[model samples]
Target: MQPKDWQKDFPVAEPQPFTQPHELPGPYGPPLIGHLLQISSEQSHLTLERWAERYGSLFQIRLGRSRLVVVSDHKVIQRILEQRPQSFRRNCVIEDRFSEIGINGLFTAEGEDWRRQRRTVVAALSRTRLASFFPRLKATTARLQRRWEGAADGNQLVDVCRDLTRFTVDVTMQLAFGVDPNTLETPGPVIQRHLEKIGPGLQRRFFTLFPYWRLIRLPPDRALDRAVKALDREVEVIIRATREHMAAHPGHGPTNFLEAMLMIAEHEGSNLTSADLLAHTSQLLLAGEDTTAYTMSWIVHYFTRFPEAFARIRREVDDLIAPAAALDKLEQANHLPFLDAFCNEVMRLKPVAPHMALETLEDTEILGCLMPKGTKLFVLLRYAATREEHFAGGDCFDPERWLPQPAGHGNQPHNTQAFVPFGAGPRICPGQHLAMLEIRAVLAMLCRNFDLRPVSHGKEVKEKMAVVMRPDHLHLRLKRRSLASSVPTCAPTAMAASRSGASHDL
Candidate 1:
């Protein structure tokens, strides 16, 4: 997909006049480093949930010297989202980190650049063009299905997160760069190991809460550097190769993102240099992979904990899809009402990016409070979804709440705003549709082929907020439906070759 010609014309908005804010209500911590030491980064969202109950939907919290205005109020989030690329922009820390990485994609870029980048990505993965990419998605899924079959055969305790990570990484590479690195079957788990470092590294830097990240060369930081550099280096080579390939084969362009961005760059919005292409592509790879992978893992975590939910999903799959049917027509996933509600429920319970930080680009009044410019805003996405005002039984896990009521039920309109799994705003995740497609396809296929039984590890599961919200464990056993009843079988392990300097096809 490519950017539309009109997106290039979007104009930057002027800053609004400042209005003095009344003394904001908050539990101000000690001089400077306010609530920084009190909350664990891993369970920060739960802490915010507790605070939301005590301090109301809107209150301030201290994390180091920073005074973060946390908003769990839906109306405030609505106001913030409604005013975008003008009164509100992503936090400077986010932009600076993207800059440090030498790339600014849709997420980090602001003003006209953000609009242009957003158009490029959305078009690339748009519904109109998604069909062409389905084969690549199916290929990777088949490999994952087979690998899981192997694990079930060995009675191995599969790490659902690790396997899902591999599946997403492969699909991302195939769709984003037209490359295939069959990670699921690859020995040594080359790409898996590298992608694993990224989330922990980014989370470490976020929690460090200082400007000396480049100077500190500790394991987490160093590992981050290595992982980022490795990914950047690979993307760069792909970009250059893509450029050469396009030059040699004029009028017949490449299929993935590098080609799409390059083709659109010459004639469209925000004149993108080679550097812009590299940065944008790299950022997509870095950001896209972690969030989708973690979200899928969280879905698994919920299903494992609640057997009834998994059973319902399996029944739905059995009813809708063929017993051993290949999940080829992904568009048909739309017809799956129960599965869709199931996904909605899982995300409501466990959103991957629980907190997204933005800054007040201008003095803005939200929910009757005037927040001045430069105010650090923490959009507590998860908390917003959990507020009693936003959702009934905010803490409970219920998929039926998302579904339409039966014929006998009273008429009560559902509060759609309660679910903000993908955040809200001009910068709300552009990749959400594609993410859901991948999750649904894999999930539909998994439930149809096998029965996933939770394996208790004695310890309760923990939410480790590493960049993305990740479950500390995915202890589940896969029982093949075929062996018990009647059936069939279905691949990227490419980072090793890249590490060894092996070139792959476009």
Candidate 2:
């Protein structure tokens, strides 16, 4: 079945004559350094959102020498994203940083190179491939359930972010390389440790005024160097093992993402290289791990804060997939409308990629703003998504808004064009299907097996941006459901439980 066309229901804005981006309103920054001193790299997204509120949706800001056009207007952002490689390309700094450590891939490639890399990634993560890979995903999730059950049995405080990261890493490794790192069960020098160091380090370099690490390597810089080398070596071993596996089982089609890419490279000689393969393989682990994990973490946070929504989702999971430990078939996941809406709500509030940075490939007009070639564009992805003008009760976490409203609701201004969590148009994330599947499976499993409680010790869960936005110091305490309570309940059982006053677990 085809996915829903979210944008089709919303009204499209008409294009008009252009205006210079520099002519837009913005706050003042210091000389030469611009906003470098004003905004720190970690909380830059928050600063941009505040600035968007003070200034209009479209404005300009200077970060060091680069004067950037900051766009929070979703319509304009969609237009800019849709015109990719041709009119806009990913910011050069992103590619530079990724290449500096030898892991640049589809995320940073441009033009024909990007197109070629995109084809391999798209095919590898295609629906047909993901369907076949469902059993592996289910197996990984079952491992997670077992781990969480142990934690629940011990009444241990679960490090939600760390565990979720491990979960994604394991899933990505198996799905991409057909190897189960099993970070969920075993403890060792995992790739997640290195990734933790790299993401924030890259963010630091991206916002820094100068390349200070080149002249002098600080402790963190030295650590980053080690992490990069370690990750490269790790991926090298996996690549060699994968090649050996393919050699042994020669004639069959690609079983995993790495094999698929290797096949493409072998067939289309000179089109892809060894460096390209390594970079893209490493990129999948990098790209897949953090975003999905963090989003799931945020979902857990939301569940703790909004108990009613949590209970409602648990009810939905029980209605659909209860009596089973986890989702058995891929089609079973498609029946989860409320869980789907709940995730949409979470992503809308706390988008993992809160903003996207791109550079103008040529002179372009966005929302009537004249953007010169090489102009830096910082698209505030979550700003317009949470605004009252776009969504009703936009600040509140209301999953029902995503579900179809009743007929008498009289068409609330739910501007679907303003929402691009996985982005829009040609260069949208290729791994979105896999990401959503992981999210639904894990969330459903959590709701079905455990009751979630927040472990924040009087400190509010705050957003921290290290290339991706994630909650800081967030943790959860999981309570395993009794076999009787965990069973799929018919209407009479549910009503009886409701009447007995034993339905307050959320």
Candidate 3:
């Protein structure tokens, strides 16, 4: 009601004179809908961007009686991110809905339950394992490339989003757990359909009329139940298969993520149950597959929007990774400047999802305002990345902003404190290292062998959000790139000065 009133409603350890949490400006929208329709699942980030412009970033909106405070300021985001398991927890409304379906994995678990499971995950997905995992990643991307090559031969349009989805699912399953769920090879991919269902269903969970939709026998509720059942069936089978394989190969040192986790579970005694194993496997599969896929799709989407940028990226891939030297031969290019910058730019512009919802563990102070326990806090990731204050030409596709600055240049580039595509702080994504390699592999292979020709060239493609955000109308054909372009055209500059190339000029 007043600038000072919300602080009294939400007392914290220490509070300063600031606007009441509720008094923070926002388009509250209708009482029931609460901007739900305005920011529909089809383009939530776009709507949020519009609101962020209107409300000046720090604002609040209601979602089914839950007061959601959206933070686009990088410093505020930094504050919330630092308060991981102790002060802020995963959003209960979304996480609880997942738990109800018996999928309470690391993403949902809080307190020590989260910490313990997270340690296991980190250990399983360690960097050493990625060397062994790289072959699988390359194999999966190569397989998808062959399929696209076939499509290019016949003048067929490729569903880049779906293919990337299949590719990531194939890679994620094998690399994470050493199973071949081969959605890429399957004609009518059952698991892929189930995986696709989850994003939309998860969206429904966050923005529906009633928060407790499982209590209601609505269409969305029934479909979500069916989707979970199908997903459970598929994932549990893989868990059983992994268990059997581990048993068969006794005394084997941990090879992939599953084996590493199994070893931990065995040595750690009875703390890790079979159900916990199954739940973690499900979480890994679901989280790993879609997030990587759609982010890559958005990368492709950016390339389509800016052809010259795409040409420069393709040139970088061609010269650097040409003839695609064996994974074992791959070197210190982990810091491949241009490639890294391109991926970074894509994530900044189009993050895996628009926002990550966190719930407060205790009464916490955000931006000097008290937020009582159970407050719904949204890290407006897309907004922060696109804000004029945080970035120069934030809406423009400029990867150079991520490149290292040239020597003797007395200039500060854009602020990147808001760049948390894989998240930050202690609870940052465990699979992030592996995900980067996977992304590099896909980007290199696809760009080297083919030119992405958008089917609807020059038309605006909107984002479809669920658990992951993807292009709603993206279709491209992989027309083979000539060997001439594959050959080094210009001596590549240090990526710092590479901005002299046409990235900004275009």
Error of 3 at 230 (Å): 2.1
Maximum-lDDT candidate? 2
For candidate 1, lDDT tens digit of each residue in 326-386?
4767656565566677677778778887777788876655544567688888777777666
Candidate 2 lDDT score relative to the true structure = 0.82
TM-scores of the candidates in the order shown: 0.87, 0.92, 0.88
RMSD values for the candidates in order, in angstroms, are: 9.3, 6.3, 4.9
Q: If ranked by TM-score, best first, what sequence of candidates would result?
A: 2, 3, 1
TM-score of 1: 0.87
RMSD score of candidate 3 (Å): 4.9
List model 2 lDDT by residue over 141-166, tens digit each: 99999999999999999989889999
lDDT of each: 0.71, 0.82, 0.72
Which of the predicted structures, 1 or 3, would earn the higher TM-score when compared with the native? 3
lDDT of 3: 0.72
Model 3 lDDT per residue over 1-506, tens place: 12223333433432344556787778857876677666676566667667777876567887655678877766666666776888788788777777776677778888888887787678767777666566676677768877888889998988888888888888878877788887877787558787788778777666776755645667877777798889888877877787898899899887666677778888877577777777777888888888888888888888777778777877676566555531223453452567677878888888886777887777766656667777788777777777666677768877877765667542544766667787777778787776777777777777677777788866668777877788877998778867654676666545443232212210
Q: Return the TM-score for candidate 2, rounded to 2 decimals.
A: 0.92
